[model samples]
Target: MNLTQNRTRIIEVLIGILATQLIVFGLAIYMFNEPTRIVEAQGEILNVQLDDAMTLYAQNCSVCHGLAGEGIGATPALDSDALRTMDYNDLEKVIARGRFNTAMPAWSKEDGGPLSDYQISELVALIQSGDWIETQDRVVNLGLAPLIPFTTDPNPALLAEIGNLPDGATLQAAVQLFAANCVACHGADGLGTGIAPAVNDPLVREKTADELNRTVTLGSPGTLMAGWANVLTTEDINALVTLIQRWDEVPAGILPAPNVPIPVTEESLALGGQLFSQNCSRCHGPEGQGTQRAPALNVKSFLTDTSDLAIQQIVTQGVPGTAMPAWGDRMTESDIQAIVGFVRQWEPTAPEVATPTRGGGGGPPWLRNNTTTTQGTGQQSTTGQGQGQGQGQGQGQAAQTTTQPNWWEIIDWRILLLAIGALSIAFTLIFMGVESLKARARPAPTEDKSQE
Candidate 1:
């Protein structure tokens, strides 16, 4: 009777211990499940906010600043270290007020611009994300900067011509003045660098001497160009103008142009497409949609503002103070004309829309016909495998395969580790409980009277 009572007591104790463990396991599961709900809710809110911010940036900021805040033409990169380290309040202030004497216009509605305070805040958040830093690092590692140096010393003969001028006078002192003041932006050779446009461009040469003098004296109001009136004398200004005019005399080979005009034709367009793909697609995007490095060619505003002659000149001479490189020496006039013709095809007044698809194809139009063949082959392979197995066995195998969880589908390492740890703990607890029960069920040691 006592032995039976002991067994009953042991069974009750095991049951109680198991109940406690089950309660603890239930509590842990509840706690883990609750936090996931909270986290999911938070994630949804954050995703919505981020999406709105991205849309706003695309609409308003992506033109000159680039779709990814990479700068193009005269614009400075917004993703640079300067912007990354800027304080939120300062960034907001700049966005709202706009910089004085620069191309950046006030964005705040209070300043007669389009954006609200909230929109500006969103933009600030996007800028602060520093997502472009990795891309910039990669670009630097690749050495994407032009190999040809833009800045070089002025010709000795040109320098000698101004020797007779007075000290500190603009013409006589042009080289020294430019070296000190302009070299930072314009490069030593007057080829445009990242900071400034090339002064040696033919478009610049078209400016009258007086217009050039005024520009030098007063500075361009909405640009980085600062007036030198306060620093240089009137004679210095005249000398500088004369020096700039000398660029007009530079030979066509030095700044090449088309010796003969190529007429627009279907053949020209095909050649142009090939040339643009090879030479222009890197900066301009494959579809001329524009990138962080170049402005969109297909946009209505660009087409309206630019003339064919202007485009030709730009292609031949290149823009100064920007990344545009002169292709005159590198490409023939016919080749350049072909590219120009291809670019012109996008210049129609109507808004450019994507070509509509004829049917509901998952891939590109060219690959639509192959979809049926791919599906048919996959079905045939599945049928062949099924025929090789018995019906019952095949069904059982299919059930097992369907029910089995693929470990590779688990992307988060933390979740996987947690699951493994819980399983181990459960197994250990069960093994310990079973060992305890077994020890209790074993016969007690009998006294050894013979040995005593």
Candidate 2:
């Protein structure tokens, strides 16, 4: 009886162990690789409907993104992983909202864009269908990219308004004014932007105050800078010149000026250089070489002039046009002095400056004067003359600085034209679309009541 019972127990135990092992094996396979199960269950893990997404993209997204997802003229290429892996919501937002600084217009409704909700969703869905595996072929990581800087739509007259500074105080004042208004685009360092010229370049330094003033007061036609005569005051124009002189002190990174010149005993040119880089590099080229449109400095006529009162006055007041602006409110006297001292240190890049044409169409008597500040002298400086030798009379070389031209009138017209164009296009498209939709919806008269 015991043997029979033992055999039966052994058999049952073996059967139980085998059954358990099979169940565990099955469970492990299911958890580890559930693709087969999903196929059988009529559901998938990742919901990437490749076919539907491809169709949606071909119909709508190819216009700007290109049929192959290639970007067109102003459009950035979407063949980047950064674009691929960006959060879906963020992609949707960017597509819907056109960037203010770029040509990427808002395609979705949130940013006053044109895409509908279904279209927006479909766009997102289609893009996701593409392979998200970031191929090492293109390495620009979109996740780590920074937002592009704000473009300066500065007034050309304002830039020209920066006068030839003879005194440290006047120069400092001008720099301060520029910092408040022009630095955002010109770069606080005076380094130029794609559209604006470098303010602190050695070449610009050679320009006579009159030339500088004329450039500032009159907006250059066909240039990115708008005129500023209407926006600024007489006091404002003088202040801008003082600011440009500050570029003389910009350090190595922002501009290539010596900064805190050897003679400026008030503040160390070292300190001035720091201040220049931080506050002036935006418009001035890095290392002081003016950018695309910015006029260069590194000249002698600006700070080495023999006049003072006039230069200081110029620094105190801003010229009429260009991006140069008034700075009387932001800076203290000591700061202005420091800037002037820094400018006095810079070496000129050119010997002679070309006379700048004055802007404005008969606005003020002051703007009409085309003569350089003579400091009572009638002779104009040649390119080879000793311009940097700091003249030390009461007012300084600034007094002889030249008169600026008028530049505000032209800018006013341009702004008006731009506004008109925007309004015209927006309204026209809206009206046309509305009319077409209305035409489509009109129903034909029918005998519906007698249909029975």
- TM, every model: 0.33, 0.25
Per-residue lDDT, model 1, residue 399, is: 30
Least accurate stretch of 10 residues (summed lDDT) in model 1? 384-393
| Per-model C-alpha RMSD | 19.2, 32.3
lDDT tens string, model 2, 132-159? Answer: 2221100111000001122222343433
- Candidate 2 residue runs with Cα over 4 Å from true position: 35-48, 85-87, 101-105, 109-122, 125-452
Model 1 spans > 4 angstroms off: 1-12, 19-47, 100-103, 109-113, 130-452
Q: Model 1 — TM-score against the truth?
A: 0.33
Q: How accurate locally, in lDDT, is each candidate?
A: 0.55, 0.42
Candidate 1 positional error at 185, Å: 26
Q: Lowest-scoring 10 consecutive residues by lDDT in candidate 2?
A: 137-146
